[model samples]
Target: MNIHAAILWEQGAPLSVEEAELEGPRAGEVLIEVKAAGVCRSDLHPARGDWPTRTPLVLGHEGAGIVREVGEG
Candidate 1:
């Protein structure tokens, strides 16, 4: 699925908003149609380079969404 996401291209850099392709749910997983998203302190920790992570990361974990599909076991 193609969706809009805030992507981190590099450490200590602001996230860039763009379209991203997502894989379908795997075993024991579900796909969500996101309704809301938020940036918390934890998000900032990595965004501001306070902590190190691999490049090209996706941000925003605090959010609300509806389950759209479920994967088979």
Candidate 2:
């Protein structure tokens, strides 16, 4: 699935809203339709280069959303 997300492609760079490809809700997983999302301090650490985080990272793990799909458990 295609979705919009806050992505950090590099360190010390501001996050950009980009088109991202999302895989299925694999076994024991659920797909969420994010209604609200927030970029917390931990997410900033990677953007600010405070931590050696991998590039092309997705921020905003903190979010409130409804479960749209679920995979077989």
Candidate 3:
């Protein structure tokens, strides 16, 4: 499945809204449909190189969403 996500490909650069491929959930995993997200300093840290975070990271730790899919039990 493909889902729209904000990808930070570079530091101090704007996030790109792109369609990312989803490999689905593995065992004891679940998929969420994000309805709302929060904007915090942590998210900007990686975007501005304030934190030594990896590139091409998905920035969404503070958010609210719904469960869409679940992995096999």
Scored by TM-score, the top model is 1
lDDT of 2 by residue, 1-73 (tens): 9999888889998878988899989999999999999888988888899899888888888899999999998
The parts of candidate 1 lying over 4 Å away from their true place are none
Could you list the CA RMSD of all candidates, in the order they appear? 0.9, 1.0, 1.3
lDDT of 1 by residue, 12-37 (tens): 87789999899999999999999999
Per-residue alpha-carbon lDDT of candidate 3 for residues 1-73, written as tens digits (9 for 90 to 100): 8888889899889989999898988999998888998768878887889888878888869888899899999
lDDT for every model? Answer: 0.90, 0.90, 0.87
Off-target runs (Cα >4 Å) in candidate 2 are none
Total clashing pairs for each candidate: 0, 0, 0
Worst window of 10 by summed lDDT in candidate 3: 37-46
Candidate 2, run of 10 with poorest lDDT: 38-47
Candidate 3 residue 71 Cα shift, in angstroms, is: 1.6
lDDT of 1 at 4: 97
